[model samples]
Target: MKLDKVNWENYYDKIKGRSPRPLLRAALELEKETSRPNGRFAIDLGCGDGTDTLFLLENGWQVLAIDAEPVALERLLAQVPTDLTKNLQTEVAQFEQLTLPPAQLIHASLSLPFCHPDSFPSLWQKIEASLVENGRFAGNLFGVNDSWAVNAHMNFHTKQSVEALFANFAIDYFDEEDKPGRSTAGSKHWHIFTIIARKMSDSSN
Candidate 1:
């Protein structure tokens, strides 16, 4: 079966009021376990309508919320409270064009798979390099068995590839989901890997 083409603008509208993704929540919880200060920087990749970005700001983090869509940033800024205005910054950029900065946390939810296959490796490398020692990375990756795997523009991975990507990190949370689901794009089967892991401060950890 052919996967329905995504209309991203409408998809953003459909999820406007949704909570932050579980991977992000897990990352936050793990970060708290470190007893670290709350003022660290975080990058919210493909931040869409900025729910995760806002969550970061609310918890005293300085946030850089990046998305390729201007409308998405506009909607996010519109919803931000007046007091939080200072803690948030936004960039309009695609994953392929991403140049991340050193950060304590980097999050992308339901976004990375949309990156073109040709650019995914470099993008992943950038993510790995930009994270500070012990910095956390949280996100979802589409598995090879996903219904959307046939879409040539999107990237999908085998479990081995996903595990390889986090080899240097101590994985904190991982849940593989393969099931039927409905999305704003359409009805489909989902094969997803939800991950939250921290960069190893020393290779030993």
Candidate 2:
């Protein structure tokens, strides 16, 4: 789908007041086991409506919230508590145009699938390069069998391909679901891979 065709403002309003994705909450829970500082930085790729972004800030994380839609950034910035403003940064940029900074955590939620198939490899490579040692990546990828897989603009993966994407990371959390579901876009069959993986050292930390 053309980025301009998306009704981002309306989409954000539709999901307003909802909690952050469980995948993000799980990633944060895993962080508690480590000795990382609460003030460590995280990146929220394709952060919509600021739910995950606000959660990160509330927990003392410094966050760089990025989304392609200007309205997305505007809504996110507007909802940020005044005191937490210093903890947050907003960027308006697309997946293909992004150059991520190294971070302790990167959360994308239900966003990466929108990346064009041809650009996904390079974007994924950039994601890997942007993580600090032992950092975590939490997000969902649409599966090949998803109803939306027929859309030529979106990227969908089979299990083997998804596993290959995380070959260098330790799979901390992984769930595959194929079922009927509702999205902001409308009702659809959802075949998705929910993942949270930690970057591993050579010794496999």
lDDT of 2 by residue, 97-136 (tens): 7899878999999999988889999899888888877889
Pairs in steric clash, model 1: none
Model 2 TM-score relative to the real fold: 0.93
Best-fitting candidate, scored by lDDT: 2
Among residues 3 or more apart in sequence or in different chains, the pairs in candidate 2 whose N, CA or C atoms overlap within 3 Å are none
lDDT (tens digit, per residue) of candidate 1 on 5-28: 666788788987999777777788
Which parts of model 1 have CA positions greater than 4 angstroms off? Answer: 1-5, 35-39, 202-205
| TM-score for each predicted model, relative to the true structure | 0.93, 0.93
- How well does model 1 score by local distance difference test? 0.86
Residue 178 shift from truth in candidate 2, angstroms: 1.0
TM-score of 1: 0.93
lDDT of 1 at 149: 93
